[model samples]
Target chain A: MEQFIDVWIFGLGIATLTYAPPLIFAALGGLFSERSGIVNIALEGMMTAGAFFAIYVSVQTGSWVIGLVGAMLAGMALAALHAVATVTFQADQIVSGTAIILIAAGLVNFLNLTLFGAEGSPAELSTPPKPGGVSLLVPLALALVALTAFVVFKTPFGLRLRSVGEHPRAADTVGINVYRMRYIAVIISGALAGLGGAFISFNVSSYTENMVAGNGFIALAALIVGKWKPVPVLFACLLFGFSQGLASRLPFGSPELLNSIPYIITLVALAGFVGKSVAPAAVGKPYVKH
Target chain B: MTRRINAEAILVPFLAVIAAMAVGMVLTYLVTGWDPFAAYGSLIRGAVGSPSAIGATMLRSAPIILTGLSVMVAFRAGLFNIGGNGQAIMGLILAGVVGIKLGSLPGASHWIVALVGAAIAGGLWGALAGFLKVARGAHEVVVTIMLNYIAIRFGEYLLGLGGPLQEKGSSIPASKSFETSAQLPVFWRPDPFTEVHVGVLVALLAAGFAWFLIGRTALGYQIRAVGLQPDAAEYGGMSVTKITVIAMFIAGAFAGLGGAVATLGELERLQKSELAVIQIGFAGIAVSLLGRNTAFGCLFAGLLMGALDSGAVGIQNDNTLPSGVATKLIGVIQGVIVLFVGIDLVFRRLSNRIVGVFGERGGSGMVKS
Candidate 1:
């Protein structure tokens, strides 16, 4: 009984805490972008940029907090490009998102190679603080969820944002600056995604190529599964995190197959096993103010 | 009228490519602080300076062309089909299985059977996405992306140590070497090290087939109608659901063939590690966009992309930059190309302005597609 509690309870709990925060940060980021009527598929790329810049900055300045700021800035820069392309130029959101992914992956890895050389980041570097065997980001992520819920549900800014997403033309007539709201939402999403990326790199104490590894997509899935609600998204992320923890601990089955459980669940959820997940009416459609 | 639109189609991608290349040069200068001209010079030499270099470009071009065609087919039916990587994995898995287990088949027939099996497996994988989209109201983009990860995990499991497809008694996370008869037939030897295979012809043939299917068939008309206006097509008595499934199947087949050709042409067996790093699916997106989503355009764009990749190898060999930096730079340029092409409206105006300089009326009579 003691062994079960130690192995299954404590170990799994710690693992879930470690993995779920990044998803929470990123999924919340998606909520912001999508709520403003933009399909931020580039969350993955933004997260990738965040992952790299976090470590690179932390290593350069010897301050993990400054590293996080740099990560957000990098993500915002990419998000700004996404905004310019999708909102200003009226480019297809998915195409622009795909471009951002390619650019983030390429540019980040290029910078990593040029800056770090073949050796990669230095062995000893500053990392996030851990309290009670859990990274501080875990509590921070949960707090953000509450904050997001409040901001989105109770705030006027949130109402305007959702209005723009649901009916931009209607919001436009009512005097909401649709473009500005979208741009701000996308940039905020980037900042949150960057924080998520930083948490991943900080946990590992280094940034490696492909470290972000589809977590952004999983967050997008979480956003859908959570029905675009903060509390439900948190549960969805925790469920995915739990599956990951279980996959790692399972002693017998094919680990590769086990590793695919989260994705399978995501597929099932997206396929409407849990119910219909409808997006904002204006989501994925470029708004043209006549 | 159609001729004029075709001119714009060709010109837009051309301008985008030039603009993207300029951006690449600027990025190269900003990042490396090296002479961009010298870097490009090395890139050009690496891509076409020798027979082997050209062979390398052709070798690289083959798989991306098929994947490009795969994307093009789906795009014509108004589906993104981002699941090319997943479909290709399914193809390669089945192809690998056939190549290893069905060694008793006669010469030429063995390889043919393997390719067919790959196409079927990939098609089924692709059709599943279409089915989900139509039947379950799930978006293809998310479904396909999820499928890519699932396929990767499945492939890893099949080839991982103690897995079903692992080489018997070898302890390597790979399948057994394919029978020589199952390998793609070599047609030319550009150099002792570079063996040009029939896979290049296969890609070309696939491109031709795409052209015929999209341009010369009633089914193609229905697909285009559904893509252009699904409700209109449905009102016109065409089944959007069936066409979508068929289009996805065709797209999957092309990508599957791409995986098999690359595997059978280059590697002797399937490695677990290669499944994760397959860039052909994403590269197909770049190729399709640059090619203007036309079958022949995909062929040319794929070749150009292949050349750029080979040129990166040249950059490495010349030591102009640190090793492995050039490929990443190529990736950035590819991304830029997609960005420029995605916003082709900006490029269209730019192209019209450029044409206006040479005595053609600028934008007065041009129609947006």
Candidate 2:
């Protein structure tokens, strides 16, 4: 009994740590874009780009920090493309986001083929030294979550941002620069999401194709289940993480069944909790300055 | 007398494609230092230069057409069915299992049994999202995406060594080879060069059927009406709930058929682990977008994409550029084109102004549908 308890506790800890950074960063990122009236479903794609570019650059430069920086820039670049399509050009948010996701996947696979080849050659990178029992990025992610909560609930800028999302036309009447706010929000969101990607590459291990996996989408689900609030979002992320960890540590049954736990949890959450909630009035609609 | 050129619609998509291809060529050259002309030569030859290549392209296009229709069907009902991948995979697994079990039956009956199984599996999988959306008001986008992961994991589990579908006394992580009678028949010999089958014809026919349904039916009208304006549709006495459920079921069926074609017609076995993550479902979204959600448009888009995919191998073999580069190139092109299309209304407005200066002849540029 004691041994089982210990294993469970250990699994919980690891899962919490694993899910924290990416989930927190992605949720906060979603908050920024969605709060500013732009539905940023491209979070997954942006994170993937960040992960791939960070590792690619880090491998070449031998600096993890620089790799992190590269990831941010790459994410921002992709986000800017999305912004141009959805914000400036007034395209459909879902289509633009889908495009971004596909483009990111394509770019990563393309670069992988060019750099490593089809046989999945591992890219060599200088491992950034880290203290045992969880890396610095996890702490950074928690801090980010707290910071986001403060900004969205307590700050004037945050209020304006939320108003923009809730009613862009109303915000525009009140002299809020809807376009500018949304652009800034998306860019910031991209940067945070990119950081999440970098954490995976530098801290977890050398990057692999599809390394960000479906975490981006999972974070999006957390945002929805949490009702787009940072604090609640954190709890949602933790729950998902815990489930994932438990699934991974199970002693019996095939590991494949374990791999599906998070998805099943997400489905349940979506079905059970998310139905009663409502999204921002202007969530997916582009704010055209007519 | 003025001649209006729907030039922007034609030109924009055309230019976007050309631009993307040019960028792709440059990227390939930069990566591999291969001659651009030679690389393209190989691409063309691989896709259409020979009988086998043509067959291969057609085979690749089969699922894309169905998946594209799946997306189109959902979009027409104002839902984004990103779960096409999941639905298609479920269909494939169901077809595989049934195909194996019903091997004793006559070939025609066997095919019917497998196909029916696939349709049911895919339909139920899709209806899961629809049920959630209506019952809980959860966004289909998020739910569908989550379901995709579940489907993938489920597929992996079903194909595991200890799973029911696994071959007898075989250690591989895949199902047993399907009976010959269960396999989709080839239209012609693969010319000793490529693998293509009659599945391509099925895909083409499916596209036509989708077009006729969407453009010429009362059910399609309800879907379109709801898509255009849900509140107005409700005001007009249309049952939004029923439309949503039915539309999703139809969409799921199309995707399920796509998987059946690939499994029964192409692979002749259920290599779930290897075949599960092929991205045909997601790529179908690009096809739908490029085709502008029209049936004929999907056919052409699927063919173009299928050809490009088939050519990727040739590019790898013939050039120093990696095989995956073509795939990436297709992705970039797809994104750019969709982006352009997303802003198409604005572009149309601008072109209308330009044409006004020329004459009234250019005013008919807007697509009525």
> Which candidate ranks first by DockQ, i.e. highest?
1
Alpha-carbon runs more than 4 Å astray in model 1: B1-5, B320-323, B362-369
Q: What lDDT would candidate 2 get against the real structure?
A: 0.79
RMSD of each: 1.9, 3.1
* TM-score of model 1 (first chain only): 0.98
State the local distance difference test value for candidate 1: 0.90
Tens digits of per-residue lDDT for model 2 on A1-290? 88867667765786678766787787788888987878888888888888877777887788778888888898888888888888888888888888788778887778777776766535567545656667777777888888998888899889888998998899999898988888888898899889878777776556677778678887787787777888888887888777666666666776667767767766777677535446677899887787
Kindly give the stretch of ten consecutive residues in candidate 1 chain B with the minimal lDDT sum.
Answer: B1-10
Residues B53-145, candidate 1, lDDT per residue (tens digit)?
999999999999999999999999999988889888999999999999976678789889999999999999999999999889889988888
In order of listing, the candidates' clash counts read: 0, 0
lDDT tens string, model 1, A1-290? Answer: 99999999999999899888999999999999999999988888899899999999998999998998999999899998989989988888888888888888889999999989888999888888898889988989999999999999899999998999999999999999999999999899999998888888989999898888788888888898888889999999999888777877878788788768777887788888878788888999999988
Candidate 2 - chain A - TM: 0.91
| DockQ metric for all predictions | 0.75, 0.64
